[model samples]
Target: MNLKTVVVGAGGISNAWFPPLIQEGIEIAAVVDLNIETARAQIKKYELKAVASIDLEATLEQHRPDFVIDLTIPEAHREVTITALQAGYPVLGEKPMATNMDDAREMVRISTDTGKMYAVSQSRRWDKNHDILRRTIESGVIGKVTAINCDFYIGAHFGGFRDEMSSPLLLDMAIHHFDMARFFTGADPIAVYAKEYNPVGSWYKGDAAASCIFEMTDDIVFTYVGSWCSEGCHTSWNGNWRVIGEKGTLIYEYDKAPYGEVVESDTTDFHRPLKKADITDSPLEAFGMHGAICEMIDFLKTGKTPQTECKDNIKSLAMVFSAIESAKRRQRILVEL
Candidate 1:
């Protein structure tokens, strides 16, 4: 089915969006941006048979797209999404849902009021390795999960808006890992105590490093440490994850395949006996943004809800906000979902 979509925001991210939609046979009705020339440039770059517009309302009214793809920046997400949902279009939006919890809650309320679907494109969820890790843990190969740990270190030099933001790592990047934690464990965050700091040699205006401890449902403890301005020994963008359960442990290393090991315990000895692990590799049918776009298109056609629907995704956003809040307050904060 060719779903006609109006995409708002003609930024760098907008470039990654179109190929996936086109692959799914979705038609781009028009591209809208505050700068019409920017929208026109994207049209020319992609060779799209679509028009460019500075006015979203006028474009939507004229073309009447089946859905809206909100590619706007974090602050503008609420307005762009609310406008489209109220205008009778479902929205597939970029991550963080909104700049803050108040805006995110309002977006969810509008989706319910309008009865239109609003799904956040949590593109990381589409990674094949992450999917493999989730499946392995959920399979109980290591028994009931008790704790999870993730470490991410990168020395990025993104000299744009990110450099100007406060708590850049927590706000701009941690949501993916936080959401992945939720997805991997099927648990919601209860509380978090976090600390954000700027390393001595860091270049960002705000904290680019953070350590957070989260209490999730089912008594799971998730620990995360990350740095966006570390100069060396960078971890995978997906991070190095260790999921510990009652029986065994599952480890996902950076730039390596994921694997698990189950040990057999005997009452005879104090320590449990280790057994040969039956290792398996989980592969992806599609990865990253492409997979999420495919899922969004399927939801539009078949009414199959995307995993990161606005209501569910708000919890993930809550984790981000709570972490930042905890850091600012220098105390533990309950994740107010």
Candidate 2:
């Protein structure tokens, strides 16, 4: 099946997004961005059949793409996506689906109203290491998971949108971690309590650090920690994850390729090194172009809204919004998912 595609807002991630569209049976019908020059540059760079423009309407009318991929900054996410969804087109955009919970809700609402697929590029969910961890949890090597943990820390994001805003690091980057935790446990969070602080530093999102504790369905507990203004890239964005269960513990490091170091259900006594499992060599890394391809292929074949289907993302986003409310009142807020 040929996918007539329109890619909006040519940004850094588009560098990774374009090649995959080409390989995954998606036809690049148009490329839209505020910078006509950038659009033109992208078209030339990728050899796409697109005209540069700032207006989404003009591009939509001219190209009539089956889907619109919004890759613009956070503020523009809702405007672009709402318009596309209302006009009878599916959307695949970037994450934190929007700047706030209200906007995210609206996007989800519009997509549902229009009966179009709306998904975010919460691409880490498709990572090989995380995929391995997910499988391990399902396989139940650790008998019934009890707790989930993730760490997403970055030294700097520059003094821009992220730094100026007081949003918690957890809200910003931890959504992926949160989503992963829920995905691994196959549980939904019932409530959340969080603590966040913006340690004085030069970085994105003045709020430097945050810790979120969640109560998942079936009494599974999850804790996530994130910092964009930290000292160094100590942890992988996919996060070094640890899942503790009743009888065993599973430790997965993001730095490792097939980043799963699983301790089986009976072997819970000692913290020994994970002997790498020799299974089918996975092509799940999103480092280059494959991750984007994986998403496109899934959409084409399965017709599943990947980011939308993943329960962790919504919970992750809820965690962020809840933390924001909690920080303001200096009280633990209950997250409504």
Candidate 3:
């Protein structure tokens, strides 16, 4: 089947989405960005068959794409995604879903109301680091997943909305970890108690570091430490998770592309090395382009939306915004589904 595709953003990570579209046999209907020059540059760089357009309405009318990829900024997420859904187009956007929960809910609603597939690019769910973590737990090498802890700490000056004081590491980054925790444990969060603080040495109105403790059903727990403002040498393991099951334990460490490690043992080695498991020769520089390929293929054949659904990810998103609310209230807050 010929799937007509359009990519709606043309900056940094836009290149990452292309190989999948190409590999999945989707037609490059158009590539639209407010900055036509940047869009043209990307079109040239990737050798895509696309026309750059300045206006959304004009571009949509011109392309009439079967699917629209919203790769815009976090704050612009709802606007771009809702517009596409309202116009009867499915959206596979980059993540955080939306910068906040209210908009996240609205994005989900628009998709549901309009019958369009809306998926977040929570691609880490398909990463080998996470796959190993999931496998170890399923093998029962770890008796029962009693608890999980994750962290996303880095030192970078990506001066923008992210560096601002209003940034919540939980919202901006940890949603991946939060979602993965639930994915790995297969449990929903029941309640959350969180603490947030911004030492005088930081950049946003939001906390510099936010720690959240989530209570899942069956007595399982999730604890997260998230921060964008830190002096430490940057590090993370996608989920960077440690699971304490009834029988044993599983740990995964990530350093992004081609450098992640997982160590499964009852004891903890915070700075552990990547496991020598049977790593596959997945064409990841296609940028795990295959996840989007899987998504598009499923939508075309099964007519069922994939895991990135706003409805499904909204739960993980709730954990993120709830932690922020708990931070604001300075008390544990009950998460409202």
Candidate 4:
């Protein structure tokens, strides 16, 4: 079926969603934004035969789209999603689900009350290499996962909202890595102890660096160290990963393919022989935003739940908020979804 959707938010991020929607044969029934002209420009840019409106309710009533794609800023995510779900339209929204856990939970509640599917587009979860990393760990090549470490360093000078936020890196960016940790380990966050700071010579007004230690389920420890203001020797946007398990470890660094080594011999020697283990890319029809769009499409076609459905995604969001809270309290905080 050729699904029809009304996309909300005509900001830069919305651009990423449109092409994927078109490629999936999903019709752009309308574009809704706070600025009607911005919405109109988006429709024009895409050469879409869709109406542009500033009012979501009016647009929904007119188009009655099959679903709603929410590309709004994090602050607007809850409102947009709740409105769409309550109006009986399934919604696929951009990440960081909501500004706060209360709002995130309410969005999930509305979706359940309305019996509509509400999923978050955690774009990183769809990467082929990420899939491979996940599968490799699941394959037990590394045995029981004990610890997962990620280091993300970048010299980003984005002069907009990100530069002004208090916990810029933790709030705006680290959610992806946090979600990826959940994706790789199949574990939910248990507790978090974090330290958020602003480094000297940083351009951002708020803390652009953070070090977080998360206690995940199955006794797995996940540590994240990142900086948005680091000047040199930057890491991949996906960060460098080191996943340690009982039998061996998997290292994904410099955005290259992941590789590791495991004990080659089961001998009781003090130091057993080690052998190389490389991760092969798993087949994926699409990656990033396109992958998320495809998953939403599949969910609509079949009753299978999309991976980042609101209920499931809230756990990842919890990790983010918990870390922030931990930073504030200067103590470990329990992650409550």
Best prediction by lDDT = 4
What's the lDDT for candidate 1?
A: 0.89
User: What TM-score, to 2 decimals, does candidate 3 have?
Assistant: 0.86
> TM-scores of all models?
0.96, 0.87, 0.86, 0.97
Model 1 RMSD in angstroms: 1.5
* Best-to-worst lDDT order: 4, 1, 3, 2
Q: In candidate 2, how many Å is residue 179 off?
A: 1.7
TM-score of 1: 0.96
> Model 1, range 1-112, lDDT digits (tens) per residue?
5679999998989988988877778899899999999999999998899999989888999999989999988878999999999999999999879878899999999999
Question: What is candidate 2's lDDT per residue for 252-333, written digit by digit as tens?
Answer: 7755743334443345457644544332244455633446445655775697556443233556678678877776777767
**lDDT for position 166 in model 4:** 82
Cα RMSD for predicted model 3: 4.8
Compared with the true structure, all predictions reach lDDT values of 0.89, 0.72, 0.75, 0.92
Superposed Cα deviation of residue 299, candidate 1 (Å): 1.5
Better of 1 and 3 by lDDT: 1
Residue pairs in collision within model 4 = none
